[model samples]
Target: MAHVVTAFLRNRGRILLTRRSDAVGTYSGKWAGVSGYVEGDPNDAEDDARRELEEEVGVTEATLANTAQPMHITDGEREWTVHAFMFDVNHRDIAPNEELAAVEWVHAPVICERDTVPELWPTYRRVAPTLETVQTDDAHGSAWVSLRALEVLRDAASDAESWEVLVSFGRSLRDARPSMAAVTNRVNRVLADAAGDTEALCQRAAAEIDAAAEADDVASAEAAQLLRTEGYDHVATLSRSGTVRAALEDAGPSVLVAESRPGLEGVTVAESLAKKGLETTLTTDAALPGLVADGAVDAVLVGADAVLSSGDVVNKVGSYPVALAAARADVPVFAVCARDKIRGDDTVVGEEGGALYDGDLPITVSNPLFELVPSDLADGVVTEEGRLDSDGVERVAAEHAELARWDESTSSGADAGGDG
Candidate 1:
């Protein structure tokens, strides 16, 4: 199969408009959006969006989704289901980069009036309508909260006054690290409960996580080795033996890749895997298929930042691409994560629907944090309890739905920068 790639680009509004640089192949300078070539792996749309934005416009990881949408477009014979994102920019001036010959923002009507690839027109026109609908849908409206809505919920959860909410939020951060603010708030909740005071919890938790960061806080290196010896196996994880690294050590030797980014999760995972006596081979974002073709990979056991309901998983920016590649290769992909990552609502089309925008570098940037992998992309989910399929996602969610204290409704909560 050819590259079933996705793109993330700006249009109307404070659009990070630019002429596509001919530095790369394919559509060169004909004025297309930020595009990516699929590495014959699973397509993680949100992450691709983030990566495209960053690679093209030098966006920081802070503000990637001001106006983001998951859309598919046909470019002649090639078909790409891209996550089209928009952001507001107040640029004093405009300039082009290596991938973009120029960058600018214009009015929506004028943008709509411009000539385009023609094949992508329908997908482009739907952007505003899609954004409007996804933004307005309330938390109670549906189970799958659009990506934009997730940001709102994270904000609401962060502002929550209840200690349980805060602690739960903190556990969310540690278990998933989806949103730093949410995690901080949750950590504060834990400290607040312990100290019986709301003040100064953030300062304290940081201190603890930092100290904990030094010495295998989740699992001692010795303990990790013991777990590895005692029928536990480690899979995909950060390079160090934190919680994720420990899990990979317990599983040992997974078919992995080097996840590059503002934060390189794969570098950490690869370095650690080598230490654990695992047969780990690092590959590029594009070489996934070749490995699969060679039959070198047995299964995909990756890590996650959060696992949403409705069977969608949020992971590193590159994780979705890897999963998409794996899925296409007919290899089963299992996410090795704790149950705590299950967000307020899972069914919400997390990354596929929502995106947030924050200005990074200058006024031009897109720093997407998480990619949404639908249950379909996953062969199974491996938790501490064991491995389960996407169907089990709904089962666990439904079981939790009965808990009167838990709200499984569609969350109007904004999910900006909520991803790890």
Candidate 2:
């Protein structure tokens, strides 16, 4: 078995595919990306990619965008581990060397229609363009993919050995995004309730994950109805949320959005609301308190990363301040989330490394990804289970005792507290 570097050089939404000339040792007259055998240290895949790009395309101005996990392929007598990479080329013009017949920039969709080397499409599919997009700081997109990934794992786990495989699968999903309580709670639920035959357990887990995915849509509708009932004609929000987006569509309220700093997720939210013709205001994060105090906003609405047993809400870094100001101004601040978010007592304040600045600065940079807002500061917690106060949050936490872990090592194996 050997390793090879296969890179897809892209620019302006098009990929550069080269036809292999007969001078190549193998796969002659085939359409493929700039690729080569691993000649240096195997761990230095990026360096190998840069070399391949320079040697094949005769260009040195390309940026590495995304690198997918390596894929192993067997071709009769030879097995090759292909390291797939996507590089953004500033200049698309390329002069093919003696190893290429022709080089053409083609759209992604056209690549499937053209003749290509074996496993090229499969390898590319592993790292679809959406993979890069989902990794963005978009909360809803990340949760959506996290659920999808769990469902995929559940399908695979159905045929896997019990206990160990389930544990490993759950751990992987939880570790993939530790700050995401939705993912952690969902995986933990499957682990907690895993029973009966392996196939049956996996099926149950898949159903639970699937139901959570479906509940996001339902929660949005329910939350929207709640907002209307509560007479929140104008809403102030921070960051972006799919559930919130759906609720806004249904509630039809004028929106004030904060420019969620570092990532600016709120900018995206504000633009989306404006595009839909909803009365929208895009303001700086510092202006949220003033808006609430001046009665410029009717209510402060936000999403939760995790709703703790202590009745605190863990969310975007600035959420606490907005809620705190709303509380001071006698404005109601409501956290709208699905029941899935109502898990875990511990708060995971993820680090936003280098998001604020790059290159070692003389001063320290603090970029905490999430923050905790005391539940009392929030007027109410709205979920598919309806609105809940701090007491109600505690009741919900007790009901799902299996998930209300204050620490990571406190999980009691196979202990389903009740009909949560």
Candidate 3:
């Protein structure tokens, strides 16, 4: 078996198809996209795709529009697992090598309609949408997670080799967005099952991640019920939590969404709630304190990126102030998070980013990823295991840690940051 890369170079709605020269070793005179054997590190498929395009058609300045999961194809006694790529090119001029007889710019729709190499259409179909999903510039939070997870699931298999591939894929996604707790939580959650029988780990991991993306499932319903029990009809939330959004949707409460600064993720949350027909109010972060002080909000319900063992929550930066205001105004603050988000007590710190404006100014802009909401300020925490008070959070955290030890015979070891 051998690995290879196929790159489709597109310009002005047409893709370049090269006819393999009769002098080529195999598939001579067949219409195919720019392709070559995996000559370097297999993981660097994009580089290989670009290299093939340059070597075959003499194009070098193309942008990678999409990359797809590898597709395994067997032709007689030989097998090839092909990595496909789609590139958007600025120019159409091509210089065919001795290995390529000629190059034709054909419309993408009619590629399969022409005489072509074996399994070309199947390879294209498998890799096309991957580019579309990954190339989406505006996907954020859970939407991004869901899209990436599908790709991960597509690559998952029930063997050691497959598990390694999945783990590598998960790690890549996690590294792409370090500030996103959901990414780490979902990745780590799936990886936890790796030590067990991997017969269905891929499917199981995909199912778990899909449920996490949906947000409005049984766990959220339970959180919603807790809100209902508390008689909260108008809830205020800063930043966005898929879990919080689900709970708000299920509870059917009017929502006050703070314009989460830096990222403005809160605006997205507010828009989503408004579209659901909820009386959603979009306000500035400064106004949240006033809203809580005026008792305009029934309670402050938020989401946690990481729920620490000490019961402190690592959430969007402005969460601390909102929780503080809620406490001062006698408004209960609850963090709607799932049990998996209870990733072991690691030191959670707010991150600083370019969202504060990248100017050549002599002033410092503070853009932290999240701030700690001390356990005392957060009156309760709602997870799949049910609602836990400040003391209950510690109890649950310790219990969950013990359970994890029994499950995996390992401990992430609690990091001391906030009080228990």
Best by lDDT: 2
State TM-scores per candidate: 0.40, 0.64, 0.59
Top of the candidates by TM-score: 2
For candidate 3, the lDDT comes to: 0.69
lDDT of 1 by residue, 98-135 (tens): 87665555322233445544344344444432323333
lDDT of 2 by residue, 124-199 (tens): 6555444234234354433465554454445445446665566665566555666666766666666556543455
lDDT of 3 at 164: 46
Q: Which sections of candidate 2 miss by over 4 Å?
A: 1-142, 155-163, 196-198, 346-348, 353-362, 403-420
**Which pairs clash (backbone N, Cα, C closer than 3 Å) in model 3?**
66-131, 351-368, 351-369
Q: How does model 3 score by TM-score?
A: 0.59
lDDT of 3 at 269: 88
Residue-wise lDDT of candidate 3 within 1-420, one digit each (tens)?
799988888654356888898877779988889988998878998888888888888887887767878888888988898999888775678888889887888544345567787788666656543323532333244334443543344334322365445545545654454444455555555556555435455555546644654443655787899889889998998876767888898899999999987678888888889888999999999888888888999798887767777888888777888888888888999888766556455557454655556778787776676788888898877877688765666665554454334223322222222233
lDDT of every model, 2 decimals:
0.45, 0.72, 0.69
